[model samples]
Target chain A: MESVGELGESGVLGRVLARMGEARAAVVGPGDDCAVLRVRGDAVVTTDTMIEGPDFRLAWHDGFELGWKLAATNLSDVAAMGAVPTALTLALAVPHDTPVALLERVAEGLDAACRVLAPGCGVIGGDLGRAPVVTAAVTAIGELEGRAPVLRSGARPGDVVAYAGELGLAGLGLSLLFSEAADADGTAHDRTIAELWARHPEVLAAQLAPAPPIPLGPIAARAGACAMMDVSDSLSIDADRLARASGVRVRLETERLEGAFGAQQGVRVPVDAMLTGGEDHGLLAVFPADVELPVGFAAIGSVHEGDGVRLDAAALEPRGWDPYTVRPPGS
Target chain B: MESVGELGESGVLGRVLARMGEARAAVVGPGDDCAVLRVRGDAVVTTDTMIEGPDFRLAWHDGFELGWKLAATNLSDVAAMGAVPTALTLALAVPHDTPVALLERVAEGLDAACRVLAPGCGVIGGDLGRAPVVTAAVTAIGELEGRAPVLRSGARPGDVVAYAGELGLAGLGLSLLFSEAADADGTAHDRTIAELWARHPEVLAAQLAPAPPIPLGPIAARAGACAMMDVSDSLSIDADRLARASGVRVRLETERLEGAFGAQQGVRVPVDAMLTGGEDHGLLAVFPADVELPVGFAAIGSVHEGDGVRLDAAALEPRGWDPYTVRPPGS
Candidate 1:
């Protein structure tokens, strides 16, 4: 089925629709001009697009993984808004030579992602077209359930900075993939690295298919979160963004994150990776100093009356994943 | 700037944010992970994508026109559902070589389109990234306002078929652009074509920057429309889809459509164009037999117990704008 032309656009869409089960939030699903969804109070909408060359490599990721990541990335945005993701719409633009089978795999991956990460959230509608390269735009609709949405600019002085998901593991995994440690001979030194890799397969999964801390968003919101956002870029860069938006200084204790970095034995993880590695899709939030940290969340930093971001009182370089600024290794 | 690379992604986004004034529906607009919107009851969601080569030609359409068409297409979907468009989000994936000014112009066009067609509905959020070609994914959110949504599958036997907005003018204009009538020289005796082009500039505008009858959606629904859809593809093809979905036959009077085609005098508009010309973004509706037609709508056909669409009681071809099946000329 190389090139969806074999099945044609409608055929491919029919197969995709068949794969989708049901969304509880959708009053009416696919086949209509619009998907009618039941909403309470406020509706949350977010959109994210992932392009082939800049966002991923076919050699490193397959259609299933791509589809999962696509859902994760978009759902994470809804989660960051402190809403329950109810429905999703995808617009896929693929090359004329792309396979229909790959799209099915992608659909399966989307279903699997929703099942594991966001149960009851189903893809209700989508648009398919041909492009020179594969690109996907996912629009997620979430309901606030009468709660106020947590904004990035709501953090204040004397707030405790907390995090709920893995930190820098995805970035470290990416580094490992780029490094030559995997190609080494079975020498003692190479064996140490291989053993670490075998023992810590979750690190690889973090990079390939990150299960973001989505549920934590509502928890933090209900717990009186002052400000919140997902850690998509590096911690330092994203922290600086939060600080700039809130007009406060973010001070992180580097020692707190050392535990995650030290999980792998024999192989030393770079401090830069822990500080600036992106694609973690973790929840970073702030709360009042007296507020109790929720389960699965760790107090890592504090907010003070100042500017910029700091790691143990030292200024950290503010750089994160900017598609226009970063180029792929060869390209 | 010649390329978006000059300003970087963030810089471009800042410029775009500056252009968007305010959205009444959005509680939290751009600059956040998700845009929070106010909803009454059921939320209507629709998505559409336009690509460079297949959707438009840079020689004929500019970024502004592309932006307007993009918004028009998505909003029309909302209207077809008998909903009021509330908010919109776009994900633009353009080549790195695309001009930043062009993107700004596109933003302006989006704002202008919203202002003219669906005032008070605004673009609340969007994403920008690099792609091999210029591709845009626009997702529109609408509110049904506590009323039951008009679906395409709701048409019944003995329903009256009505249409609001232009029919084949856009397609005819497209034909004219590709026809020899556009040639500068007045050598041949194609005076009829030249006179038609000189007389009806609105036809070209209808093709390029169509101001669709979006506000009539709620009106038609209040008038007790049973089924509704936006005619994005050829009327014959889309009508057939509606008929098949509803398990009924739509009988369109060629005499009724003749008035639409006759607007372009002296130009022998192809019958095929009238039947199959798409991208007009007109509203087609089915109403109860005794329901009075809306102000802008004219009854053009009738519904009966059958399985396919008919033209003056004759079966029409079951074909329309299927991207996979229809290749652009010369591409």
Candidate 2:
């Protein structure tokens, strides 16, 4: 029951550092003024912010899951750049009354994500602060390993648009959670919700802790990926971003998208979720037209000399999860 | 004035990108999944966070100044490692109702800091989100330039401790501000504080926008510094940190400390502030006894075989700004 205020900053830091083992890229790790890392060739850096209210509901998620999501969100960007994740730096601002045990769980989650998703990558540096709400700011650094970065601007007209990892499962999971909450009345209790959640573990995991295709980034780059990005927002919205950046248009076949969404049993899969559901953390990449598709990638669309994203000859609206417009579920 | 809610996330991001300009180190800047930077050799990475309530007060500091301080706090860490700053990544969480113009000012401040303090170093990437309070998390990347980083643990018993830049000035500035605020009544106005502030421009600048001795970090390393770190908290506190890391005791001379104090005519200088007041962003370094002190650095203490820090043959208490215990002035 002891909170972070009782445990103190140094105590919390000691727990975090203990969870994060030695990093291969780090010459010097935490406790130093700056972490010294070995950077081979170009270094790719990306940063992401997740707030308690807008990004997650603490009632539905624990510190461990939050930590994994934070790492997934940042590492997914590193993977999108066609680089190998080398190191990470985290800045956490939490309420003074937050449980130190919760923070330790968060550290465990971050460490587990790094170990499972991007092996050898570790947290090199971080900061802890007191705040009203829990906020995580993660920066992921990656090594290019002698390959040119697969930028979003490199998509040519004749490129083949492909994706690695689940597309709309996270969105479906979120929808399920929302529906479950809405159906709850005065009689609903934690026990019933737990039973309900137990029935749909896969969908909840996709929403709460996405396993992004981190390793496929380098593989796609080696296979001559023309352009690449992580599908953090809506598939349509992010695809439109790639199209605009590359000065071309992306056209997705409905049948192909349907094929990707095979055997949806309990949850009713919404088509809009597949197109606009964000937080999937999947890789959306464009490869050379003649290049062999990477092992994990499946062709979902194609690029042409036009603007914007289209589906079945119809222009798709670039709408996704806009944090400003939508309130966090249960908030 | 238009608020960030009206502008939306992408609209605000576009404005921020327009202000960032081109970065020398980044092959890809903002508007992408990741920013790719050309890393020469080894990379020095550090991260720091500043929250509105604890780290800073909006009533006392504006967005532009807050931006600069955020950069200074992170860049100073890079300087402690004896590296050349290359790029920075920022993650900002602000209230949705925050003024768009204020965010622009924040961007201006970030740009000005990079232009003035560390030329060629730029903000390569950043993330923005909605939160209850304004928070800035900054991660600075630096190149070691083929020199081994001066770690805090490398100090020897015979090492001479030196400091670059002002000591205890920022804390003094905070004290001045606090006193002025406390003295204000119905009769007291802005004019009275301005009059009080006119007497100590140096101290105010040191607190509001500290120009840390960043260049001195590399210079000290090249000059064979045994250990180095930025004086972020208090002189004694940071010195104690260096001592603990090096497993040695640091002894400071009273006369030498007085000499560093120079002439304090307008305001009475507190000895405790001089020893324990932090936020100075000064460089605390240890060098071989025979090595010539680098330009702009003044010898302050000597390292000896023992534990903890001492002044004039007595143990010095490691008291400084601990964010967990102290509230911002006038909060």
Candidate 3:
């Protein structure tokens, strides 16, 4: 399996959701870009906290980017609950030496992100504490409008598999970050791709501003998908998860996957990269054979009568993100 | 205004919520016992975090007591929301040196507290992180069957102000902590309030196991409370808040207050302590003239048309918890 942290943030999220224990009121838990909470009869709630060194750092990710990521992450939880986000509460623990404007800009990013991703959801309440580490926890509430929340455990066998939202982009962007390059500012620049990461400055933006295939989760559910999951981790690895949970076998057509990804990036991704790379935050669902999938998804696999996932007819290995675990060359 | 931090955790929460920007989905924001989040339909959501140094110290509060406090504080948020808490998610960050037995004992406390206060809620999901601080964040969700959820903004003039929990007990317990008193086992000895606190031991347990008057939020709301708030800080200080927000004057009947308080402690709290001590986490609400309050609440005073909190027809000076700006008496 890929190193959990290396598969990066979204990958870790996907893997964690797979291991989530069942809780009745959970309605919707981690995975699918956000965790939706069924508040009561009319609203949904969600909260996300970002740590300094583990989630982000001033050294690598700027404060504004951190702010945007924090809001996006929390709001995604509301979305996952099938609820329209309505408000956000922020609790901040910041070091004293940090500039005040930085905090303001962080709030600015939160406001801006709300404007873009959740228009009706505004920043409302929160706490401010002084600490050496800068930690921000955003709690969001949403209105479900009488819709059933989609959950990670709803997947089952005989369901047609489908996905929406881009996969591998954020992971590839992060991989590019380790490259050595420079820009006009005499600082190492970021690239959108690993090869260009050192040559340009967009790489950091992609890593910090991960655009989770947000809307697809509900859309897939609405389309009558039986078993569904988010592809925040590598495709093959997540497929294996679906297979295990649903008591079915997941098969992947490597050629079709290569064509789909190759056409987007103008280069052929290593099979393992498509199989083990993480941070996609895309939706992966299964529906009845008659259901029609929305655009942005290519049918690259299917689930059949079996237990767990397979690729081209074999018992596939577990290859998703695992922070405390080790990884192999391909993984 | 009082230095906000002087009120300790609960006081700080009250002050911050007082200034919480207005929003449509607040249903209940901060203060109270718990934050009721209107999630999907009629569900409520609340969250809280417990830190090692400020919230708990291993050298003082034991693992079970710490866990009980953590659960109590988080559950209090749900109660503040006026919701029947249904579940809880805990994200705990601890140092690698922490023993598994300590973790188990903490879980035991979690179980015990839930059995007492929140039978509907249990420790749900959790994350274990390696850190120097034993950090834990619990996001609790509840349900509000069909009540007009209560909030902090409804106080009206001519209302009777009331409270449903002890004041200054935890703060007094904390004071005993800094005093040069301890039994051989490091646990205070037992029995009388003074012995349990000063001479005996179990009194420290009250400070450790602060069972929030969680049931009062909903009860107060049902009692036609004009404006409801929690008394996390000193009575004088929090009363002033209700007064100011309601655009009214608050007059504390010190004699009656001392009478009721002395019956329990056998000690009349110093005027300074009564005005500045915090961390009671009790419910304070304003009731209409026609409403009769439930048991345990005394009509501390009345709210009249005016501005700011008043005491015996005089401007009450603010002095509560404020970590950064507070100076010890005679300092």
lDDT of 2 at B249: 95
Clashes of each: 1, 1, 51
Tens-digit lDDT string for candidate 1 (A1-331): 4568777788888887677667889899998989999998798899989988788766556788888999998888898888989999989888877888888888888888888888889999989988998888999989899999999999899999988787777876665555433233211123334554576667667887889978888888999898999999888988998999999999988787665444533445555666777998888899999999888788888999999988897887787644334432332
Better of 1 and 2 by TM-score: 2
Q: Rank the candidates by TM-score, best first.
A: 2, 1, 3
List the pairs of residues colliding in candidate 1: A3-A98
Docking class of 3: incorrect
- lDDT at residue B239 of model 3 (Cα atoms): 74
Question: In model 1, where do residues sit more than 4 Å from their true spots?
Answer: A180-200, A259-271, A321-331, B180-200, B259-261, B264-272, B319-331
Which runs in model 3 stand beyond 4 Å of their true positions? A1-48, A75-87, A140-144, A181-203, A265-268, A321-331, B1-46, B181-203, B265-268, B322-331
Candidate 1 per-residue lDDT over residues B119-234, each given as its tens digit: 88998998999898888899999999999999999999999999988777787666555543423331222335445546766666677677789999988988899999999888
Per-residue lDDT over B1-331 for candidate 3, one digit per residue giving the tens place of the 0 to 100 score: 3321233323333332232132223343332111233333355455556666545566666667777777776666556545566655445555545665566567667657766877646643333444456666666555555664455546676778776666666666656654433343333322233444455343366567877677776666566666665565566767776666566777666765676564444544665566666666666677886799877677777777777766666778866754233333433
Q: After superposition, how far is residue B221 of candidate 2 from its true place, in Å?
A: 0.7
- Taken over the whole model, the C-alpha lDDT of each candidate is 0.81, 0.83, 0.56
* RMSD of each predicted structure: 5.0, 3.2, 11.2
Best by TM-score: 2
Go through the candidates in order and give each one's DockQ: 0.83, 0.89, 0.14
- Compute each candidate's TM-score over C-alphas: 0.91, 0.94, 0.78
